[model samples]
Target chain A: MSGLLSPGTKVRVRDDWPETRGPCHIRTPHYLRGAEGVVEKHLGAFPNPEDLAFARPASRLNLYHVRFVPQAIWPDAGGEALVVELYETWLEAA
Target chain B: MSEVLETPSDRLLAAVRQLLTDKGVVSREEISERIQATDAATPAQGARMVAKAWVDPAFRARMLADGAKAAEELGIPMRGMPPLGVLEDTAEEHNLVVCTLCSCYPRAVLGYPPFWFKSAAYRARAVRDPRGLLREFGTELPQAVKLRVVDSTADYRWMVLPLRPAGTEGWSEEQLAAVVREGDMIGVTFPKVS
Candidate 1:
C-alpha cells in the first residue's frame, strides 16, 4: 500500500536473468528485461506468480502497466508503443 | 531419430489428474464437466458485447469502465477470474493484445487460445515485430495510427474493441456481430462487411 509507484513514473525493468533458477515461472518477458519505460497505470497488487508456481507461500506485489516505444525494445520495430504489466519487484527507478 | 510419445508436461498432467482423483479432491465427472464448460465459451460471447457497445452508448461506457462486470451483465460468469480490460480502437489508434510470457487469455469469453497464440514465434514476434505480424495476418495500418500492443503478462487480461468498419450503418446487432471474428477482437484482423 505504501510507496507504490504511480503512473508516468520513469522506470526500468531489472535485467536479472532467471536462468540460474531452473524450472521457474516468470511473468515478465525476457525481451523486456533491461528495457526502460514509463508507468502507464497501476493494476493493483496480486500474489507473486513466481512463488505460486512452486506452491510457495507468496506475498502480494503491486503491478503496473509499463509502456515503451517499440523501437526502445527492438531497434528495428515500428514507431508504435508496447505495454506490459510488470510486478513492482521487477522494476526500478530509471 | 528416436520417436517420442509424450512430453514432460503431458506426463505431469496425467500424474496430477491421477493424484487428484486418488485423493478425492476432484471427481472425474467434475473434471470432465469443467473441461466441457471451458470449451463451451467462444468468440461469439465477445462479439455480442462488441455489437451491443456499438448500438448502445451506455453499455459501451460501462464496458470501457469495467469489462468483467459488463460481461457479467450479459450472463457470462467472471467470478474468480482475472480482471478483463477492454481496449477501444479508434481512427487515430489501434489495440493489439498478446501474452508474451504465456497464453493468458480471457477464457470465460473467448474460450481457449488458438494454437498459433501459444507458439513461441507469435510470442516473440508480437513484441519485436508487431507490424510484420499484423501484415502476415492481413491487417494493414497507416503509420499515423498508433498501434498499441498490450502484453497481458500478469494478472489482467485484455481484448480489443476494433473500430467498426465503414458501411453497415443500418445493420442490426446480429449482422454486426456476424462480421466480428475472433481475429478482430485479438487485433490481428478487422471485421469486414464483405
Candidate 2:
C-alpha cells in the first residue's frame, strides 16, 4: 500500500521518537506531566518501545497507570494530593 | 570596548555563542541552522505569536489546544514533527524541559532549546531530582511554587511559554515579545525589562 513507510524514510521523529524508553535515551514527557509522588500503583498494558522506536510493527500495545504523590512531583504539592498516569510505553522498571 | 555588562543583544549572543563554540561547549553548525529557521515567515514568526499570547487568552487557549495550528495562526507548521505540546509556566508553578536522554525539542515554535537543556547532567538529574536541576538553572522557587521537570523523549517534544512578567500594564505586543527571551519561554529565565 502507498501508506507503507519508505525504506528510505528519514529516521528522526518517525522512527526514533516512538522507540525510546529508558533512563539514557531521549523520551517523551507526557506520562510525567504534572508528576508527583512515587509508584503507589501500577496498572498494566502492551508492546515494547524498543521495537516501536525503530518502527517495528506490533499487533498490540499496553497502557499503564503510574502513581506518584503530588509532593514528589511538585515540591509545593501539599496535603497528599498526587499521582500520575504513565503509559507502559514510557517506562522501564526503576 | 569592554563594558562589564554592556554587550548589545546581538553582539552578546555572538560573543557568547562564539566563545562557547570555541571551547567546544556547543555545536555551532546546528545552532546556526536553528537561527536560520526563524524570521517573518516562520510560524513562531519570531515576535508576533509570543506577543499575541501575552495579551489574548483565547489565542493562548488555541496555542495550548493545537500548538502546530496555533503557530500556523501565527504561521508555524509541524508537519515533520513528532507529537508536540506547549507548557505554560504560570506564576504558581515553573516548568523545566529536558530530553533526559537526548535533545528533543519543538523547534518549529520555540526554536532550539538551550545547550544545558540537552546535557546529560541536566537530563538525568532533572528526572531523578527536579529541585536540584532547577537550582542549577538559576531558578529557586519559594517554598510555595512547585517545580515540574518534564522529559521530552522520542514520541514528543515540548516547550514552555512562561507567564508574562509583571509591570507591563499596557505594553504593546512587540514590547512584550522583545522581552520574551528564549530562556523565558523555556522556563529558564523570567522576562526582564531593559
User: What is the DockQ for all candidates, taken in turn?
Assistant: 0.69, 0.12
lDDT string, candidate 1, B85-149, tens digits: 89999999998888887798988888778899889899888878888899999888888898999
Q: Which residues of candidate 2, in runs, are more than 4 Å off? A: A1-49, A58-86, A89-94, B1-47
Best of the candidates, DockQ: 1
Q: lDDT of all the models against the reference?
A: 0.88, 0.56
Report the lDDT of model 1 for residue A39.
Answer: 92
How far does residue B24 in candidate 1 sit from its true spot (Å)? Answer: 6.6
